[model samples]
Target: MMLENSKYLFDRAQKFIPGGVNSPARAFKSVGGTPVFFDKAKGSILTDVDGKDYIDYVGSWGPMILGHAYEPVIKAVQETAAHSTSFGAPTEIEVEMAELVKRMVPGVDKIRMVNSGTEACMSAIRVARGYTGRDKIIKFEGNYHGHGDSFLIKAGSGALTLGSPSSPGVTKGTAKDTLVADYNDLHSVKELLNTHKDEVAAIIVEPVAGNMGCIPPAPGFLNGLRDLCDAHDTVLIFDEVMTGFRVAKGGAQERYGVTTDLVTYGKIIGAGLPVGAFGGKKAVMDVVSPVGPVYQAGTLSGNPLAMAAGFALLSELQDKPVHYDQLEEKTTYLFNGLKKVFDKWDVPVHINRVGSMISVFFTDEEVVNYQTANTTDKELFRDFFHEMLQRGIYLPPSPFESWFLANSLTQDMIDKTVAAADKSIEAALESSKVDSK
Candidate 1:
């Protein structure tokens, strides 16, 4: 209820950091409030600098699946730091992490480590183009693949949060090459492929789109993309930066039963650290760097600390695979509860969920793509955001972002969140009416 300290911190941060946050969305500009500066997070709870506690649903934007400050990840990082940090040379842990990732993620036989999802995605597109001898790539409008120049066209996440899906500074040439498609719509993709034909190199997608509020592919949509890619010789790349490891050990590829030629991973891979990777069949990956002419390298690509943290997290996930099951149960429970709350208030809302990723739009229209998602009432979302924050429930500050659930969220936490939702929904409904007047 008290945000005096958080307000002071934000004021100070604004002096140096742009918008009082390193990330655009963290500024809470969309939600209309001073962003809470978290002092610490343990398990599923976050304690703000103002000493207010909240059940965290953002999960550090999808990397804290096993929960914040997970012991194994911490110990691994500390142990690795004891020996050394970055060697600028080969390490066994890198090989082990790659192997573990390949084993956990189906269809990946080789991999390249990178510092962030943007790097991995940008590198993946390069490799795809090099291997296929093509120039164009297709990506869904609302499915974010990071800040790569090619991916900035109609990108989501922070881009959407700041009301600039098409950022400035991206060259016209880069934008021209990156073809935009609609999520869950096979016809849009088909039209592009039909026109471009052999010129398109890869069709990248988030199989379970999280950037535009956790919208899952409509039935047979993924299969349609795979088939189209196969027929046209376009590489099917799954940008699983958010869904990888969190949705399942094998990720959306396994969950949806559709395999891709190359898969990019981040988020849970580093257990909240700065790490990302891309991999697939050896024949395709062989085109990268030392194997062939397609060059992609990172100085901190496989830094010891990130590799150790990733390895520790992946190892635990492999051993205890049911973490996803628990996550799904919790998410489903929360989803149903929120739906009930919305129904009680008679609020016009739509929620999309899969596994632990979920989102609620303040619109009655079904959120199938970027166009429909934009139809949501942003003003209503701002009110609901503040209402929930007042009651100690921290959600994604933007409506278009997914609510990432951590495995550490207990039944009691879910209950408390549902109770908060009931009040928040009522308040949002009243606020929307006021705004309309």
Candidate 2:
């Protein structure tokens, strides 16, 4: 597709905005091309500035589950905006949102809203530390828990894509308390708990890791972590910013049947609005703000506009619980179709999927953790990505990121996407053969 206007916009944006994008993932640095500037999106389609329409698979990085400009969400936002935007005070909508969330999600006794997932995660850790009176926390490798200073160490997604999991700005002192463990590996977590003993306050993890591709927790992985936390007197936190309400209504905790002490949410909770929330058992959550010693506050925590949009989106999901099943069916269809295409093209690829979240890694090995996920042939993926883009299918810019499927995608779109994959795989295979020679 010709992106002249997008290129122009990017050039102009770079004069003011660093890397011509606010978010690093939007820069298309890993994909080796100019990022397409989208003018508008509706349903499962994104129309770029140059008037090229592509089937969107990124879903705004997991928020647009119902799809872009979904009627209910848009209507709610419009209706709420006419009243006011931010009041800096509590509203009935906030209370309603909390009640609705608690009704749908399991194990959440109280929830605090925030502007973004990063803030939710950062505050959750602070609350955990305050509640437990311990300073250290263990985080799994390859699980991107937002870009908080503590989470930057061995982070995934943007950090891994930029080849800097440990960012420069984060101080050494901040990194010390953050312990890193391998995902899908129970032994590593047990080892960390044994070494840290009473010093560890919490164990944070992405129950269904979306960063470093879509890796699901191993057979007993989540339960094992829960057990370890129980034995160590540590708070177990599920950073479900990506998996929450996407994989399942209540998220990984609900799907896996393993309860967590704290859970952080983003994306779907705000219905694509800038919002996030962290909630847990009343005892742990009580430590935040007026009730307890932990200091955490957001001026725009539960902005009326955001609450309305989120409530609308959540209500739809609540009313139509079948949407989850429909999403799974579509995702399975796409995954199976892609697998068939790769097989036909004789391209060695590993596809990881969990519900509506999926990833295509150009490798034969199973991608269980960061180490294995890194073994993918990025060059082949870049070729595949461009080929798919050219065929009007928009994939995640980086192999480290998950492709979020929206309910808006029809069977026709999935079939077209499969056809695109067939051609893309052929081209990628040809390119790999040429490179080998």
Candidate 3:
């Protein structure tokens, strides 16, 4: 692929934008290279600024489940935008969106829209605090609930990619109230709850750990949390920002059959637009805003364009319901194919997947949490990433992030990606050997 255009764009981008990208992970600091500048995308392929075509696995970080340039979503956005974008007030579409979400997701009695996942999560925690009248929140390590101040400690994805889990600006007072627990370990949670007693307001977690690369809940883990929360009168908040609707039509809560007091969702609900939401039982959500004292407000909370696009995408899913099966089949096919390729190369890689979310860790150890996830051979992963990029396979830029598979990915693309992986693994091994010397 030609890189002249991409290189030029990145150079210009760095002069104005910190780290040459708006998102920290986009800087490719974890992989050590220039990020590809995409010009357009359709179905499963991304066309970069250099005019090179590549299979997309990132799926715009989990909202492009239907694929890029999806006609229905585009048309909906265009039509809705014609009647003014922001009202700073409620619209019927907002009600329609909430009703559709209620229809698809059985437990949510009411939902409030926000501009991004960060807002959804931050708002949910405040609601929890207000409703429970407690001062602390327990968050699982490596389970990123956006960059909210309380969530920055031991955060995953962008934070981990930059080699810093805790950021500098977060205050010591804020950090004190945010308790960190180990993912998949019920004992650590028990210890925290025991230590905090009635002081903990909520236990927020990513039902399927995506930030540290697609680690699913261990058997009975989520249920255990529910029990613990119930016993302690603590609210359980599901940060389904990445897994919502992608894993299932109703999100992980429906898939796992584990109910939570509140749930936070991200880009998937907006059909890849800038939107998010946090809602669950009316009892808890009533604590937020006009109903109660806990304050939360946004200028573009229910922007018509986002509401229209989300309704279109979600209605399609609710009607067909076959997209989930297709997504599962394709994701499993790619996972198995890539597994065979890695096995053939004698590489010690551990791959984890739940529904369409998956990741490849360079270590042989099962990546159940942050500690095991860190054991991955990042140097080898960097080499493998570049090699795969060279072969027109656009993976997530960092090892710590999950690779979101889209339903638009066809069998042919999967086969091509598997074929590319064989050569990429070989080249990566060679590069690793040279690096050692």
Candidate 3 structure quality by residue, lDDT tens digits, 1-437:
46899899999998999988998867789888788999999998999988899999999899999899899999999988889888898899999999999998858999999999999999999999999999999998888998889999999989988899999999999999999999999999999999999999999999999998889999999999999999999999999999899899999999999989999998988998899999999999888778889999989898898899999999999999999999999999999999999999899999999999999999989899999999999889888899999999999988999999888999999999999999999999998788889
User: Which of the two, 1 or 2, has more lDDT?
Assistant: 2
Residue 231 of model 2 has an lDDT of: 91
Name model 1 segments beyond 4 Å from true: none
Per-residue alpha-carbon lDDT of model 1 for 97-206, expressed as tens digits? 98898888889999999988889899999999999999999999988998889999999988987788998899999999999998888999999999998999999999
Model 1 scores worst on lDDT over the 10 consecutive residues at 24-33
Query: What lDDT tens digits, residue by residue, belong to model 2 across residues 318-416?
Result: 889899999999999999999999888777789999999999988889889999999999999988999999999999999899999999999999999
TM-score of 3: 0.99
Least accurate 10 contiguous residues by lDDT in model 3 = 25-34
lDDT score for residue 112 of model 2: 97
Off by over 4 Å in 3: none
For every candidate in turn, the CA RMSD to the true structure comes to: 1.2, 0.8, 0.8
TM-score of each: 0.98, 0.99, 0.99
